[model samples]
Target: MNLSTSNQPQDSSIHILHDKESSHQELGSPSEDTDQQYHHDWKYALKHYFPHYTYQPIGTVQIEERPSWFYCVAYGIQHVLAMFSGVIVLPLILGYDSNTSLFFSGVSTLIFFIVTGGRVPSYLGCSGSFVSIILTISNYTSTSNSEMNTNTAAVQGAILVLSLAYAVVALVVIVFGCKWLEFFMPPIVTGSIITSIGLHLSFLSYDEATKSSFDTYMAIATASAIMLISVYAPTNALRRIALLLGTMTGYFIHAMCNLKGVGPSIDYSEIASNPWIRAPSVYFNLKFDSSSIGMVMPILIVLLAENLGHMKAIGSITHRPMLRYVGRAYLGDAMGCFVASLTGAVPFTTYAENIGVLSVTQVFSPLVILFAAVFAMLLGFFAKFSAIVKSIPQGVLGGVTIILYTLIAITGIRIWVVNKVDFNDTRNIFVGGLPVILATVMQTPLQVNNFQLDGIGAATFGSIILYQVLQGYDGLAMYRKSIKSAFNKNKPRETV
Candidate 1:
């Protein structure tokens, strides 16, 4: 049925048919006709982007289709739960207020949506990649409280610079497009850096988890629960919340052990005493340290890779050419990072966990994600929620993070696989493997004069430089071959 030219009343709302083919074609990443229809009117685009309407339960809800309010709220909460385990860890470990992090996550997500014109459905979460760097730069583990406060300010400033770098790149992509990014940061380099980050953090998480016998057990239990639920759950929705449920299970077991005097006692005082609803203090002391900025700069590659990879992934799922909107996606991420850095929150990224949820449910409506953002903001206002989050046992956190980091490492490998990165080519092998080795082994920061570079930064620069050097050699070899060919051709006729 050609609904396009129907004589029926033209409803002012954006109408999507229940037909899968029609929905798939019309709904994702505004087509040329849709663009012409809006005539580049952002106000009109914004209104149509988030129209208040309900649709029948089609088999799959594409990015443009808004589901009923009930499904929107339910799925939104599920998204929040899915990402919370991985998202909240960075803040809690870094001593940032978890509530504030939660709030900014939502705010950043909203900003991302507005910047992207609500076309890219993504959830902003605390970037795990920055955790190790921030800790290293701040000397967080060893600093005294007063010194730590100063260090924290320095760290915030570094993040601010990082976001600016990110924004600058986004502007470049917006101006010149994203194709050149492949020349500089191909899958091999991107994948290796990601693997290095995961490996570096895996060691840290493992150490934190195994600090004591009880902690070891808690880590085991937590990881085991998440794995079990994720793999064996009877329903998809149940599997989606595996992280949250696994953490709860670990917490329960830890509490039980504490009651039996087998582990440290549970702390309930803070939860009971904290106010129900209170504003979280905003942290904003930007002290830009040159050394810190140098340390933080390398993460820009990872953020770029993540943002691009996410758009491609979503594009593939929704069957839309999402890379066309890559610039806007990058801009959205940069703005989100800016919001996070300015507000003393960690850098934000497009969450793979929430992406996993979208892939499973086959629902990509931006409005549902909007609901999730609102819910996350609401979570930040309840002081008790933050208290309860804080109350979770350290061992449980250890277990959860270990799994999360390992998955991150595996994701890098996945990138290599998806991109068909060949190890048989000797150049590819060195390009991909050596930098990861450097990052994994170089645990401590390497200092030159007053500047310091961590393992990840070293690996990032190492891979890029190595790749360029190899390309230069290739160019030289070609030139030499061409010269020899020319010489032989000139002499061949006389010799014959």
Candidate 2:
């Protein structure tokens, strides 16, 4: 009777199982088949965009390798162009002087590339999640300035110190025994975060979608056209740099318009004077004050938690065998913050824009990134190149950014697709989004002393707690009432 009906196939299955130990039984169902296919799609996308990380045997035979000189000069400049727009935006939004912000952004990017597994095929740029946090700090600092000589350095010190603390906690959690954390970070949550990032960026993208005069939407159209080509078209390695190519295309479109108005103004005297081989004068004699350091703990914790999940999501994208990328990324992130604080640089993190680039281009070599990073640092010091980069019409940058953000949104969708989740469950819908929505819409509605959480986080946890408690009572009460009703209905013997 114990004998099962299952029969092992003899030799009919010719498909070789390359995974060896791993089988369809690993997850207890054939459904993982879909998951595996989705994973394949994702890996293909990651390799295409980040060719520096993933090896393409076919590519070796098709294209000839150039001497290191031409590689460093030509391809390096392209790499710089790819990540340059991303590197400078952090300071712009953080309320720093243009020169200082630009310097720190550029320097921080260089440090990231040089340090964080230069073979990871990614760049460091401003993280959008940090935008809200930066703005929050600015508001607090500005509001508190009149009451006291509010120290920006001290605030940054707190962020750096607290951020490191958070990273350590995450690092420990990942290393020790939090593999269970994987369950909650399913595609739904990942997609929401990615969507949130793109949703936010749309405000800026719309600005770039039109011409400088605001009379024509040609630039935006050109940017969009290029994005479609990059995302959908079949082309070789050179054509894969769509965003870079798109921006150039938009510039030509703008130039044809021949408007007299300039976009953002440029300055190059310092870039001209900056030496190429000199030690970077970073980590300025900056010191943080002790006051208000405690206030930043929540943000740090939030980012730490968010980043943990983000690593898994990125892991799903790259076919890199381990979470080494995440570990190296955090190490770089913490180091970047430390350097940023010391050098008067803006607080920075891994840029999601570059992540989206991976989704678009199947290339993933670390060497290509190493080339890109060094060139960026050189460009940071080179004033002349900086001027031309800066002179790129705002509309052009905006148009490309619109596309940059779109890829980000798509990456989120891809994550969701790969994760087989039960969206049919109403509880899931409520659990995943309700809290964030509530937190964002209603800030500090309920205050128990100074412990006031915003709408989403509060509403989220509150509703669940409330529902669980109420559901328990309601179940017990209904059970008791039902028992009484049953007794009354079955009392036929006594009544007779």
Candidate 3:
């Protein structure tokens, strides 16, 4: 239908036009009646922009739409299960309370939703990128959880500083746009970063799973179950819940073995003794030391690469243009991490695991993620629930994580494949390989001024700088031309 305006007060007639003919028409400057109509239209758009009520589900629900309340809750629970291990494991490893991690994850995800205007479909979880550096700076031996807590303040301080650094990077992206970031983190560099993250964490998977022969066997069973369910499930619905179902299957087996006194058994005493409700304490976990800053700030590179990759992946999946939201996504994630730091939680980033879930379900509803956030928040209030999460045997988590982390690495490779990055070009090879190697090298006990430059951070910085240096002015010009051509090709056409 057409929106039309005319000056005549009494004689002006309303006309209903066909869809092809209907167009907004302005006869003259808006009269009193026209002004009221315009105001109404404006209000309608604004109200719909941030919808509160559930919307009917489409073929594959859009980010702004929702399924039924029950469906939303079910999808939300699926997302929670998808990201649960990654969200809680970091804190468990670092000796921080898992309850705090769950609370902040929910809160940060809500913050991300508000900041992105509910456009980006992602779940904020504790970051794995920070693990190596936290281990180095805190001198953590992983021998005693108490010893890790003793250094929690120092690690938190580093994260706080890194969050500020991320904020700065976000500001730059906001001002300069994704093109600025693209200059350094071209597809090749980004792909390598993704691959390196998986490779870096691979060792942990082996260690955690192989603690004993039984644990190793259980890990294999868990991973295999997840793969099988996701790939060969009988129904689409079953595939969507594959991660949750697989994890539960593995857990059941572990529990069964425990009953027979064969494998590691979960201690139920912790859950039984824990209270039903407790507020998360906000400790001043800040300790400003220059050395810590040197170590932690470099992680900003890893976070940036990861956040950018997430935006790109979601954009591709939803078939929506995400160029406009890149800066806000970065800033939102940074703000989430900053808040988490203040509350004695680990650094937060958009969870790749949840994105994998979205890819499988093809459900892009923000409400589903919002529901997950609410559930997570509720879980945080229950100390016993947090204990139950912690009670999942390490072997099971490792099995699942092996799959999750491997998928993360494959995602990077997929980016390269999708973008058709030219491996034939020697420069592309150097651009991708050098940083990853350097980062791997940094994994050792390498230090400068008592500050350890870990693999992820070192690789991130090394890739950016090395790529720029190696590519030089001539290479940059060609890259810019390519980007300009692609942008022009994708530019929308105006309708008459």
Give the C-alpha miss distance for residue 209 in model 2, angstroms: 7.1
On lDDT, the stronger of 2 and 3 is 3
**lDDT (CA) per prediction:** 0.76, 0.48, 0.73
In the range 372-421, model 3's lDDT, one tens digit per residue, is 99888877777876677667777887787787667767877887898899
Give Cα distance to truth, residue 205, candidate 3, Å: 2.1
Off by over 4 Å in 2: 1-79, 89-121, 139-155, 174-186, 204-240, 255-318, 324-328, 353-363, 388-400, 435-496
Pick by TM-score: 1 or 3, better one: 1
The count of backbone overlaps in candidate 3 is 0
* Candidate 2 or 1, higher lDDT: 1
**Alpha carbon deviation, residue 463, candidate 3 (Å):** 1.9
lDDT of 2 by residue, 164-183 (tens): 77568545443432332333
**Model 1 lDDT per residue over 1-496, tens place:** 2323555323232232213235546667455566554443444534555433347487888765777889999989888888875557667776667788888888888888777656678998877678888888767751101121235778888877777778888776665556667666778888887888888777777776877898899899999999999999999989988888898999999988877889877778888999999886677778888998888888888788777777777877877556656777777778877876677777787888888899998888888888999998999898988778777777888888888888888888888999899898898899889988998888889999868888888888898888878868674565565455434522211000
Structural similarity to truth (TM-score) of each candidate: 0.84, 0.60, 0.82
Give every collision pair in model 3: none
Per-model C-alpha RMSD: 10.3, 14.7, 7.1
